[model samples]
Target: MMRRWARAAVVAVALIAVSCGGSETTETTASITDPPQINRWVTVGGIEVPIGTTDGPRGGEWEPFAGFSHTPQGAALAAITQSVQLSTASDRNWPTILAGVAAPGEGRDLYAAHRGLVEISGTDPEMVPTIVGYTIADYSDTAATVDVVQRFSDDSLASSTTEVVWTDSDWRLHLPSDDTATITALDAVPSELVNLEETRK
Candidate 1:
């Protein structure tokens, strides 16, 4: 079930996200701060993802998906929010979500073409995965790499790494040139993961 959703939903548009290798350099300009506590969770496509009322997304023109703070926590939050939005986007909302959250790039253009096709002919995906937690892989003022941990109904876990850049005044999703930078099945959720669901409870 999770596999089917991945192929139809996430994989179809998930290609826009940047790769794991290049562009994740950690900056030494300042110390990394702890992410704000999960004060709430907003359900998207039946999945509940974290939200920190005090720290950020701070809100924007895109409402839930835009205007994150410039802090590492803000970047992390933006990554998680956009990852879920991209994974769950359907024909009705993909374009708006893409425009609102993604940085302008060739990768995003290619993804829009592919996603438009899916919207035209593909069936709406079922079994969208739920985000259980996340980890910040790297961070800097200009760019960040966030690994989002998702949990299937069958209890399997995987990490979906996304890159967000500080574009204009807010964090925007940075799509890479390739589609191979998405999810990786995990033996277990990492110990370092800031378990959102667990913490909120």
Candidate 2:
């Protein structure tokens, strides 16, 4: 009879210990907080354009390019156009007219060639003309869209927009949505063309 009683006492003590342990675990779990969602816009080129959060029914818009000047590509294009102006009194400069007119990568080679010519000339390198007044518009986090606008010396304007996706703590270019053929095509094209073509279509 003593042996049976001892066995029962042991079982009772074991149950009490398990119940106490479980309650403590539950309390700890309830007290723990979840981590915040990752933000991606912070990482791309360390470029931080201002973004406005939506409040109630009002949406926010951002313009990143309002005051930026002197991008390498823009400067190079301006140099080329200035060179053309010096060679001939044409009313329109070639480089300025062609800015943002072709595929994104296509203009790089032409701009580089212009830079070479600017170097060959004895003009002050700084005054040799650089890109000015480039702008990024509609920068957003909730809607995920951004537009890039570049202006040239001859008053020509070129603009493009691309879809943005938040992932891994950075905003990545979202693949063109497949729900609409038009949107898919725009996404397939270079970012510069995406905005203009989509608007027209």
Candidate 3:
């Protein structure tokens, strides 16, 4: 449980850096207002926002995870788009959280066991982040992956590669084990978003 939360938090940092990190954000044709609705997510520059299943409409929290794009890539992008939103949402609004996106049967079981294991404070989130652009990083007949550039409000930038698998219901994100550990283990340096003022100085 602890490890999953750690992985989820690190994944959040990575995605946020990607969504909001770049020095200059690419103009996006995609846009949306907050509270994110139930199941709807946005995609821009081949990067789709990812949000997984909610507590369901029971609390009026979210709609069922349905209405995905029929195309495999499209469906994967859609789920990822929502995942980004969930990471940025007020932790308190989601007091109980599930760590990853997974298949219905296996996913539901995991969620049931781990639900409420994580708590988000529901604090007002920082500047809204955005998915600027992405490219298909890897692909198989049944699976697909995306490498994305994400942006934060201050124009800080980061990049991440996400994966997805097709399930009977639709596509779901394939979260890495210990996402933060995984990144650090790669022995990579963090990229700082350049400041124009600093450059000028």
What are the Cα lDDT values of the candidates? 0.65, 0.23, 0.38
Best by TM-score: 1
Model 3 per-residue lDDT tens digits across residues 7-39: 434544544232210012122222211112234
Off by over 4 Å in 1: 1-33, 58-64, 120-126
lDDT of 3 at 33: 14
Query: Top lDDT: which candidate number?
Result: 1
Clashing pairs in 2: 40-169, 40-170, 40-171, 65-135, 65-136, 74-131, 75-130, 75-131
| Evaluation by lDDT, superior candidate among 2 and 3 | 3
Ranking by TM-score: 1, 3, 2
Q: How much is the lDDT of residue 84 in candidate 2?
A: 23
The CA root-mean-square deviation of candidate 1, after full C-alpha superposition on the true structure, stands at 5.7
- Which of the predicted structures, 2 or 3, would earn the higher TM-score when compared with the native? 3
Give the residue spans of candidate 3 off by over 4 A. 1-61, 70-73, 85-101, 104-115, 179-201
Please identify model 2 stretches exceeding 4 Å from their true place: 1-143, 175-201
TM-score of each: 0.77, 0.22, 0.48
Ranking by lDDT, best first? 1, 3, 2
Could you list the CA RMSD of all candidates, in the order they appear? Answer: 5.7, 30.9, 12.2
Model 3, C-alpha of 28: deviation from truth (Å): 25
- Residue 6 lDDT (model 1): 56
